[model samples]
Target: MSGTAEDATDATTKRQRRGNTRQRIQDVALELFAEQGYEKTSLREIAERLDVTKAALYYHFKTKEDILVGLSQDLQRPIDELIEWAGTQPRTLDTKREILRRYSVALADVAPLFRFMQENQAAVRELSVGESFKDRMIRLIDTIKEPDAALTDQVRCTSALFTMHAGMFALRDVEGDPEEKRQAVLEVAIDLVTQAHAGAQSPGKPPKSS
Candidate 1:
């Protein structure tokens, strides 16, 4: 019984250790890719920086592209899940507003992935991550905008997301705390959603929101 218990403990420890090593590899790889440019960074360099043998690193990721794909896949998983969940819900303004709120939270950590994506557009394209990215954006917009939404209102919803994305990079130079800027951006986005929702509901009503 003691032998069995000891073996289980050792297995658990090994699993935990492996998980930590994988996360560390991801961190170091991203840092290096940012510092040295993805095209120039090699798996050997990554293994060297992590002080691990190339074969050990290869056991986790066979190539630099594999590491990048892993990073993007990790970052995009939540968004893909959110989009899938939203697809099953009834179409309503409330649902759309909630989607925006949830999406804001989902995107909080994705800022870095976006940074890598913008800098490595060609790699992302080559890897075909952009296909799912575009598809998810369409689904998200469908959740928010009315199917019969007027072009202007559609523009508002589209612009709302663009503004939120722009805020991530554009407001980097702005004064005040990052949280404050995030709230301000959220407020603006929520206002856009509210306006679009109102316009869709009110046939002859004045502007729903600006």
Candidate 2:
């Protein structure tokens, strides 16, 4: 039993070390991709920045695109989980507000990846991860907006998500606490969704005389 326990501990340590190395590679690759255009950044550069041999990097990721795809997959897990959790909840104004709050947290967690995506739009568009992310956004929008909502209300719901994205990028250089800026952005997004939900719940105004 002691020998078995030691073997398990060794395996766990190896797995952790491997995970750390993969994370380091992903971080360095994202930095390089953002500094230079994704098309121009090479695997060798990522390996060099990581202070690892090309072969060592290759053991984890065969190509630059692989590293990018890995990063996208890692960052997307929370958003995907949020969408799943939202599906299980009742559709209500409170639910929508909670969705925005949770999404803001997820976006903060992956801000660097999102910034890279914003700067490298064309390159990201060509990748599979880009398409996957777009699909996730559409699903998230559906969760917040009523199916029969007015066109304007639908726009408000859609805009709520973008507001969060734009807020992060726009406020990065501005002087303020990061969490405060995030809360301010979240407030605006929740307000937009609340307005849309209220509009859907309220009676329509009577037609005006010509």
Off by over 4 Å in 1: 85-90, 203-210
Residues 18-44, model 2: lDDT tens digits: 999999999999898889979999988
CA RMSD of all predictions: 2.6, 2.7
lDDT of each: 0.79, 0.90
Q: Per-residue alpha-carbon lDDT of model 1 for 1-210, expressed as tens digits?
A: 999999999999999998898888988999888776788889889999999999999888888777887787765787778778888888776777777777777667767766666677676676656666777777677778888777778888987777777777778678989778877887788788778888888757656442
Worst 10-residue lDDT window for candidate 2 reads 201-210
**TM-scores for every candidate against the unseen true structure:** 0.85, 0.92
Clashes of each: 0, 0
How high a TM-score does candidate 1 get? 0.85
Q: Distance from true position, residue 44, model 1, in Å?
A: 2.0
